[model samples]
Target: MKLTYYPGCSLEGTASDYAAGIAGVAGLLGLTLAELPDWNCCGASAAHSLDAEAARALPIRNLRLAQRIGLDVVAPCALCFNRLKAGAKDLEAKGERLSFRVWDLLDLLTQPVFLKRMAARLVTPLTGLQAVCYYGCLVNRPPKITDAPTPENPGNMEKLLQTLGATPLEWSFKTDCCGAGLAVARPDLIDRLVRRLYDRARRAGAECIVVSCQMCQANLDLPQARISRQAGQKYELPVLYFTELIALALGHPEVPRWLARHLVDPRPVLAAKGLLEIPAPQASG
Candidate 1:
């Protein structure tokens, strides 16, 4: 199936691995992705808080562009997905009906046909790996815009994890906030939130946290040492993008390159579980 892909800013920068993994998995599944032309930011966490007009307008611009293409839009970033959906709702409220549909990539992947395709291509199932699926905040909250079945607790990622042969731990804080944009401004608060998530996941026997949001991965994965220090405890848990695990299961060649981008290296845990193989070094002339 071909869809218009809205990668958002994170996918082009810090979260390029996520973009790579998504592309890899899509290729493996025979899904075609056509990027939206000249797409702009969807005005994430700060926009709605600062300027409501710009917040709504920015995503609406993209929605209009997708409408022109006449294909469903697939946004991999949770923040982007939320903003686009919000824009669509706002336009609908104003009676400016949009012709296209917006979908979170996870939601699209969870459909029965896609899941069946993924199952057939699984070469390395993540057996024995215990994980906590983190939804952060914006992905499924404000149910009207996101249309999530259970905003307080989402099971899409867990279902995908299970399909990949990983054990998805049932835990609290599945839909809890991950300190969002405050990661830079009030790290003290962010630390506390991260600590709570990590502590709970560890208690639930989760070796890692899997997430669909770039912000959650940045907060939980990038600042582990600082959060550990602040909490007076050590948390060496790996925070992985759901796409990365799917790519691994599909035997993507770039898996090692994508895994190398994580601040909290997941290879040690993956290797220990015999789920990862270190690529052989290239020879020099």
Candidate 2:
């Protein structure tokens, strides 16, 4: 029920809500998230692009700490997860000499015992939700990070969706790009990517788009209005972090907390469907 939780830099700052949401839901799910004693950035895109050794080394430090404590690490950030996963895969593949040891957070979280425990704790009814799970291009690509189901067609998220009682909509955009960092530099390109995903999700009859990558969520969720305007089509799918949907399925009352900082509000869609529940405040410990 417990694993070393690496919140990464984003989770500690602007994405604090994601960290809280994970903590809150983990409590309800009877899961224990133990934070690493000292953790640093996994050097996601920046590190990998600048220096491969440093990029691998950053995640190795955290993983080494986890291995030392005899507990596997669980990274909530997609970029961090990808970095750590890539490092572990490289080490495993080439038997590379390591100044430190490392392991994939997915390795621990997806273990049968942990997954079963998580499924057992998911009691909130999800009879009404039809979600299109998006894994984006980071964690699943380059073949080094995610190990199973291939990048072109992924099912890990769908498996988790089924376990939580929601129907996973079949869609081609699950593993497609959301135009990522290009959102700032080349919004026109990002607009095309977003429109493609939005159109596909709508065609597949998804109630909302579920994502694990924060950057992907930021790109797709925030700019829906602008993208729609540019494409000259009405698109209004509620984009959410997978953790947020999991929290809702766990019967947490504070659903709105997850969307407070979102550029587009999804409360109306949930409200229109009569699934919006005022999330009750949790007593601070």
Candidate 3:
């Protein structure tokens, strides 16, 4: 099960932890990942807004790179997955048939082969952790592009969580927008959106929020304090990446490093569940 991996810009930059977790989990699952050579940005949330042609071209270029390697592409980032799927659709519309497939990591995990491997590798089952799987806006929108069965009510993450011994809570706002890419420009709106998500997750008795998008993680994790302050409430929820949880279940050595990168500390939550040990600070001169 070798695939051309596209880490994309976000995975290389702000979401490097995601990249690590994916790589680690893939290794554990015996899935070989060959990175696309010299790949460029997929022109995420901004590309289509400015120029449709450029947006399509950027991802198509990467798809061609994957084709050269003669393998399907696996993009872990939701925005990257959407852009690549859109690019393939654009080419198909123009009568250009591509030789390979583009798969979101979530889609790949749903396969029986991967699920079997993942179950065998789970040393520490995440028992008693109630979570709401947040799909954000782009992962499964426009049905045709993403090929998601129920875009409004996705269950991929929930299914994956169940296999790892975690409880995926039922809740609304699963597919609602988390103010994607508008964090800086219209934070007021973002705050409101985050608040709604938090309120719902809490109402559903979820201890944390699990997401597949880096943008959603940032909006939900980083702005918690301010959003809480603005709403005259407190939200101490731990927002985690699906990959990170997989790494924890697989007992990956770097799980601590991945957990350390979160804006909202997840150690407390993990510690409470007896799932992690907070490493002691290093002695310094």
Candidate 4:
């Protein structure tokens, strides 16, 4: 499977580890993600608040570019996927013609086809791992825009993890807002939300919180120290990108590189589960 790939700003910057995992796992899944040429920003957490048209323009231009390549576009960032989906709807309203589709990388990969290859490619299944799949606000909210039938309790990530031999713990905060976009404007709110989410995950019996959003990963991972300091309790829960876990399960050589990019290291937990050792390289089929 081949599609146009849009690595939004966060993917290249804060979410570089996510990008590494994406790159490593694509080959294993027999999927090709061609970067959209001359692609630009997709008006992430900021644009729509100020001007609707201006926000739509950024992703619309990207859609047009994907249309040029005549392939479906895959955006790894939740915000980018949301923006692109909204932009496509805007174009549809204007009676504009386009010849491609936009998909969230998470939604795209969980399809049956990719799911089939995952089982075969499992060099090391995360059998003993237990985590809460954290899907932040933008991924499946506003059901009409995202076309998510089960937006309330989407099991895409859970299903994927089960396929990889990992147990996904259930938690009510699966689609809750992380308040990451408001970190600068209202850090107090971010702290409160992060703390609640962390407390909930811990209470749910999860060893970690696995996420698909850059902002969620950053907000959840980067603030644990401060949260612990303020609350006078240690919250060492690690936040890991779902892709990183996949890459590790697939025994990607770059797995260490990807894990190293995390603010709160996940190696200790992975070590405790005996999942830290890199499997020896295997020849291609």
Candidate 5:
């Protein structure tokens, strides 16, 4: 199964580990990712707030590129997914009066035929770990932007987790915000937001949080030390990219390498549960 890929800025830079793991697992599962040529930023949150047209146009450009290539696009970032979905929904709804291109990556990947391949390609067996799937804000809120399913309590990630053999935790903060863009401006705000989400995940019995957004993962993983210092308690919850967990199930070689570069290591937990058979490799971060 081949799909056009939009790496966005995060995937090529800070989230390269995730991109690599995803690519590795795709190869192992016989899934092909064709990156859209000349793909640009999806305009993310800032663009949406300032210039809606640019936000829509950015994703539209890539969608049109994908259409020209005669393939569907796959965007791993939750923000990008939300933007693309939003642009596509608007285009389909108003019949081109919006003066912006239209298309969604989700529309392509979730087709019955492709979904069947994705389910069949489930390689990682997350048998023992209980994970809380985190979608943050982009994939759900702002009614016009996302409507693939009800923004509240969507189960796509949970279903995918179950199919990959992981126990999905029933957590209330699954769709809650991790204070993404506020990471730099209002670190305290993010601290509170992350602490709340972490508390919920812990209370719900999740050993880790499975994330599809780079900022969400970084906010959770990078700020734990400060959070612990401020709160006088340690919160060492593992933040695993959804793709990284899927790679482990697919039996990819880079899992260990990816784990090592994390701010909070997940190896000991997987090892303690006797699921850590990933042979260590030279760190690649």
Candidate 6:
């Protein structure tokens, strides 16, 4: 299906790997993501804290751009999705409305049709890989604003992983804050937050933490070594984007490049699964 794609700020910078996964698997999943041209930032975390008006306005402006394209808007970034959804809610509060719907990338992808396409193209299944899905707040919290079903315990990531043949472990930190918003100003606090998540996930027998948010990935992946050094223990869990794993399962050519950009190396664990190189599927008779 065709849809307007809003990548937000992270995809171009810290989350480029996420972008690559989307690009690699879009066609296989029957998606046509036409980038919203002239799109600007969705005011991520700063605008909402400082200027409420701009927070609403920024995402609204991008939503208008999507409306011009006359298709539903699909924002991959959790912050972007939250911001746009908040803007849409604001429009309704003011008795103004848009012509198109806004969809979080996870919500849109887990639908039956998309799942069918994904299953059809699955040449490799992520069997025996234990992981926990990290929602990182904002995406599904404040459910009235985001309209997420079961915000406290979202199953989108788990369902998607199940379809890919991966075991998604249930954990209490599923929707916990990753401390991304405070990472810069209060790294000491953020470090504690990351440490808690790492220790929890590993204790639950997960080899990695699966995330849909770039901020969460950065928070967990970047400062790992430092945290390990400070604590005198190894918290070596690889924080991975769900898209990266999807691309690997589909044998997407761009998988290696995306995985390389990660700060904490994800290769060893992924390599142990024999997923480093995927063989092209043999032709059917």
Q: Highest lDDT, which number? A: 1
TM-score of decoy 3: 0.95
**Which prediction has more favorable lDDT, 3 or 5?**
3
Task: Return the TM-score for each candidate structure.
Answer: 0.95, 0.84, 0.95, 0.95, 0.87, 0.95
Cand. 5 TM to true fold: 0.87
Q: Please give, for residues 1-285, the per-residue lDDT of candidate 5 as tens digits.
A: 776777789988888877787787667656688888998888988898899789889877766676677765677787888777776776677685333222233333334564466567655467888889887777667656665467888777787677668899898888888888889889989999999988999999989998877878888999999999998999999999877776776677668888887888888777776667743543453
In order, candidate lDDTs are 0.88, 0.72, 0.87, 0.87, 0.76, 0.86
Q: lDDT tens digits, residues 1-285, model 6?
A: 899999988889878778888888786676899999999999888999999889989998987877778899998888899999999999889897888888988889889897777788888899889999998898898999899889998999999999988899988999988789899999999999889999899888999999888888888999998999999998788888888888878877777777777877777787788777642222110
RMSD of each: 2.4, 3.8, 2.1, 3.8, 3.3, 4.4
Please write out the lDDT profile of model 2 over residues 1-285, one tens digit for every residue: 576777888787766766777777677656687888887788877788889899988977777776667655667766787887787776667885444333233334445665676677765656668889988876667664665457688777787777767789998778887878677788899888888888889889887888876777778877888977887877788777777766766667666767665556666655555556642233231
Candidate 1 global lDDT: 0.88
Model 5, position 165, has a per-residue lDDT of: 82
List the candidate 5 regions with Cα displacement exceeding 4 Å. Answer: 93-124, 278-285
lDDT of 4: 0.87
Candidate 4 C-alpha lDDT tens digits along 1-285: 899999998887877778878988898788899999999998776789988878989988988888879998898888899999999889898998778888988999889988888888898899899999999988898988898889989999999999888999988989989899998899899999999999999999999999988888899999899999998999998888888878888888777667766767777888788888743223210
User: Where's the lowest-lDDT run of ten residues in candidate 5?
Assistant: 97-106
lDDT of 3 by residue, 1-285 (tens): 899888888888888877888888888888899889999999987899899889989999998888788798988888899999999999899998889889988888768887788898789999999999999878799889998889988898999999999999999889999886888888888888889999999999999999987888888999999987888878899999888898888888888777778877787788789887665233110
Candidate 1 clashes between residue pairs 3 or more apart in a chain or in different chains: none
